[model samples]
Target: MIHLERVNGDTIWDILKLTVADHQKNFVAGNDVSIIEAYIAITSNGYAFPFGIFEDDTPVGFVMIGYDKDEYWKDAPAIADGNYNLWRLMIDKAHQNKGYGRQAVELALRFIRSKHHFPLTM
Candidate 1:
């Protein structure tokens, strides 16, 4: 089963070691870079929340949730206070193509729902 864990010091190294395939390298930024960006965004504006994807306690991927009112939504009044973004989602090259990505997204959406900023219909 796929699960999410806070990306603390213990799991940071494992997440940093994850990478995409050579042919897909240009499509996604390295986890190391993403983590750094997440950290900066988190500390500066309290928006990004980074997590490590785990399967049976083994780190398999990384995902981050970013909430920004101005930067993301162009200041939409309805969602002005809360604009949730699935900022990043990545599975290691070794873990790709195994349905993990879909599961990870499911887990992320579930997590976001639990936070419950506004009503979600349909």
Candidate 2:
């Protein structure tokens, strides 16, 4: 029962406390840093969105996905418009290896599909 919820004041405290294991710390940036970057993007006219991964009523992980249209597409032409970058996905150490990551990704893909942002081809 994994679902994503927008990061709001009610969930910010729990989100801020989420973390990875000490050994895997170098693998990804901390959630706090990621959230800050998301906020900056939100305020800077970028398409950054942060979400908290939940299992039932518990917050077990976090994911941020969006694209900076002005900056990201400038350097790379492969990514088409309406495409979103999966910026960050982190599942806390306490609840890892339980298929949550895969479920989260599936949900994200479904979300993108639902947006119908891709340009139709003739």
What does candidate 1's lDDT look like per residue over 2-116, in tens digits?
A: 8988789899999999888899888888888878878776566546778899998888999987766434335446653556788788999899888888998898888877776
lDDT of 2 at 35: 88
lDDT of each: 0.79, 0.80
Assess every candidate by TM-score: 0.82, 0.84
Worst 10 residues of 1 by lDDT: 68-77
Candidate that would win on lDDT: 2
Please state every model's RMSD to the true fold in angstroms.
4.8, 4.4
- Model 2 regions more than 4 Å off: 70-82, 118-122
Residue 37, candidate 1: alpha-carbon lDDT: 76
lDDT of 2 by residue, 5-93 (tens): 88889998898889999999998888889888787766665677788999988999999887635342355456735568888999999
On the 0 to 100 scale, the lDDT of residue 15 in model 1 is: 92
Worst 10 residues of 2 by lDDT: 113-122
